[model samples]
Target: MEDRKDSELKTFCSRNILIILGFSSIMAVIALIAVGLTQNKPLPENVKYGIVLDAGSSHTSLYIYKWPAEKENDTGVVHQIEECKVKGPGISQYAQKLNDIGTYLTECMERARQVIPESKHEETPVYLGATAGMRLLSIENEQLADRVLTMVTESLSRYHFDFQGARIISGQEEGAYGWITINYLLGKFTQKLTWLYLKPNGGDVQETYGALDLGGASTQITFVPQDKHIESPNNALHFRLYGKDYSVYTHSFLCYGKDQALRQKLAKDIQAFSAYYYVMNFLNFTSEEPPSQEKMIDTMEKFCSRPWEQMKIYFGDVKEKYLREYCFSGAYILSLLLSGYHFTADSWKNIHFMGKIQGSNVGWTLGYMLNLTNMIPAEEPLSKPLSHSTYVFLMVLFSLILVTAVIIGLFIFHKPSYFWKDMV
Candidate 1:
């Protein structure tokens, strides 16, 4: 009887150990499943930011861009987050009053600080690019232009963000960067990955749109033409984008911008008006008081002021008559596009105007950032993530298999002892 009781007690203890092992295994599996689910949850993105200030002839604009930190080397990853238009005229206009130019940027700098996160201020790069207006200013008055740039640079340096050098960009750079900006925003440089290691349908030939940017002081035309015989050596630009070589024809018509062209038209109109007024004895003018470009534009503005008000009421301020005083300006644009550049009317359909694309403004700033950041890699990246549903399914299937194996091993190890107990 004592031996039988001892065997019964031993069997009871083995049964309890088996129960505890089974409970612990179930709990372990549950804990693992919970941990796996938690680990799989998507984390917040590690984002980097940049700022570019477009100091155009007519106005100044600030653009804030952001991209994922890990995807900086990926094409089409950069995106515009916010854009702030600085009040008042372009910095070039402040040639005589250089001190005020710095003051003009105060509001914009404050706004940028508010828009970008505080932590990114140190790393974020701020660039100031003076466009055609400053280019012309530099040509006409080098010292004054230098003063303007220096003042703006000094002001920008006061801000918390990293200040890159401020300088006047050439017309060629403007055209090329504008092209890059449009193509990148259109996702022309990026390719989608496939499972079979084969390119997607229609992926062999990349379809890219030409960029036509019309600013206040200059206009740019850049396009990849099949005809390699470039009309002008200065207009040809070769670039390797996303491992694809592109031979493009680009041209920037200086002093052909709306504002400058308006000034040009006013100069001609004022010459005629001055002659007529002197002949009529309506106005007095001397050799010392020569009619300047500024005087000409002001005269034209006064002459068209009444007509502009009427034109505004009739056509919402975008009528041909509103620009009738500067009709020569419109004719100049047409002549430049058709005759000067030899852009065929048939090819006009491919030209996309640079104003805004998908809510973001299309400009050289976007391209400028991409180049500085080294975002466009030569070789294509092969890494791609699996689908969300597939990943979850695989994890759950793995967990279930692991649990089954553990339970089977426990059963096998205890089988000898249980069998021995029963036999005894």
Candidate 2:
């Protein structure tokens, strides 16, 4: 009787063990499917389309991005269907004289709509962002913005494209969003990049990045850090503005742009660089008995005639550096910023140069993504290549976790007398 009972007990245990293993296997497969769904290429698989409108102080314009059926995820970045940043009086500056601005926006939309191929037209979602020039408008001039908005909306209504909300974003927001747009476009080839998410946004670590965005109306300086690395709302580091201590460490300094700056006396012969510091340095000739601020203001009243001969006494030995850095036009400023910036001879090679740009779309988009994705790595000791160091650590940790999970799963299946085995 004892042997029979023992045999029966063993058989029962074996059967239960098989049942548990089967269930566990099914659950593992389900978990894998979920992970795959989440981790698979983040880019959309369906036919993709989008429209980006940059409503500026001088002009409102549109850009159309699309992709064919086979090349779904590759839309918007490589191919820009239509890009029209027309030249017009910023509605706010002109105030009551905004009717032409409204009509101009309509024309841009109409031109964009006509250009985007009809096939990809139906499903595109249009997103618009207005900057420096638009944000500074007085309440009285705000009606011109409304008129432009109305004109743009009316023209775009011809197609299935829906109107996205437009915003006159602060400099910090503008800087962040600029980064986001760059990352999204660059995310296509980012997998090939083995370094810091150049656009590491807000997490628990509070990313300490320097954002310098120069736009047509104003410029911004944004510095945000992430507290930690988590995908929850609480994982963000705070945003700080440099100009206003309690506020975001970002500023939208009014009338400091290349165009606006040149029209003032402080502008002097400062037509070379697009940044305030550089421009200020160029215009402030030490030997010429630095002109009064009021005199500088008077100089700007003429709009566009530069007086350079007066600087002969002021430019000592540093004239070459100033000329080199400042000589580029708005379009050429990007390269200068990316070139070897001088920090110290040793560090200058890698110093992330803050080259002056004429716009903020790049910085603003990036800032937005960093905050939105919560990818900021921890604040490790600042090594020479700190970002690279953090990136390597993250990749190693992810690989180890993945490998361990796979090994443990195999062992559980291979061992029959494991923890989940049934007992009778």
Candidate 3:
């Protein structure tokens, strides 16, 4: 009777164990199928586009960016789809002939119309942001700058695209946007850039990086300084990205740009060189007082007309003494970074000059588009839905765990009946 009872108890436990194992296996298989189905589903055909015309000091470039409609709110989703270079100096150079500025953008704007899908033209926002060149032009001759802007705006308005605006962006905006562009390209803003837009009151951010940009007419330095106390009020910029707040220091030296600085230096050098010649002429004749200031000015003007104008006269026939002011330009850049920004020797090495980040050019244009279109979401999207490979890995991991747990439970509960069974 005792032997029979023991056998019955073993049979009951064995049956229950088999049922549990079968159920777990079925559930695992079902879960895997569900995951597979979800993973294989076709992605939606919902793409949105935008166009940005970067009117920098040296040149102009048109960038067309696209992102999935569903992912518009996510950060770093907007990517450069196509970039077209405008075949001339930046629009600011056309300040004198403002009408010509409108005509010059014809080819590039037409290219944009062709590149973006016909359907997207009406919805797609087109923005033109002029950099240092326009900024200087505005400061020097506000009327001319306004006329140039009007010309470009009128030209862009004719296009099918939603012409947003054409104007000279502030130096602070340029620096901040460039910083955002780099960090976005580098995948630093994984979740949300900051809670800036959503919260009207204020908030903080996740992480940020420094950005250093060098352009023909201006240089910008921007970074979230560790120390909160900023000496210069103009240099300090306050931003709230995603939900995080950041205090960044940014400075743009007007005449310190590579091209302008080089021009200024060349002008000074020519004046000095011409003085040497004048002194020789004076010594050869009689020791009279040097020529008047006006004459000296006239001599300097002969050498310092535009660099190109000077090049035509001096370096037209021979290319021997071209780019002589490079040394002065380099020195000016160093001084701007060191003495102007108060960058120490140790920290100077950390500064990075980025023309491009990843595949896209590191400029303010991308960030500008992202901001206007609300690409950087206030809330984090579901952590990039797990990849197919990740799903497979996780499924296998759980299956193994289930099997191991079942086996351990069975062994713990059901002891071997005989010595021979245990040995087997």
What is the clash count of model 1?
0
Tell me each candidate's TM-score. Answer: 0.70, 0.44, 0.61
Clash counts for the predictions, in order? 0, 49, 11
lDDT of 3 by residue, 1-424 (tens): 9979977876686667767776786676677777777766775456778898888876788899986565532433678878887877778778777767767988988888888889889988889999888898898999888988888989899988878898788888888888878777765554432422221222334446787665667777778777767789888877544334567788776766666766632322111001112222322211234333334334445434447656656555633233454334444544565677776655644444444545676778887876665633333333335776798797787678577757755664666354225644
* Model 3 lDDT on a 0 to 1 scale: 0.66
Tell me which of candidates 1 and 3 scores higher on TM-score. Answer: 1
Worst 10 residues of 1 by lDDT: 268-277
User: Whole-model lDDT, candidate 1?
Assistant: 0.66
Error of 3 at 239 (Å): 3.5
List model 1 lDDT by residue over 1-424, tens digit each.
Answer: 9989987976786677666667766776776667676666676556778888988887788889886665522433677888887887778878988778767988878988998889889988899988888999998989889989999999999988989889998887788887887777666765442222223244454756677665667778777776656888888877655445667788887886665766732321121001112211211112333344344445544544555557556556443533453434434544565676676646544432234556666788887777666642333333324466766776777677567757754764658466555656
lDDT over C-alpha atoms for residue 165 of model 2: 53
- Give residue 70's lDDT in candidate 1 (0 to 100): 59
- Residues 21-111, candidate 2, lDDT per residue (tens digit)? 5566565566555544544435543344556666554445566554333321222222344556555544344455544544556666677
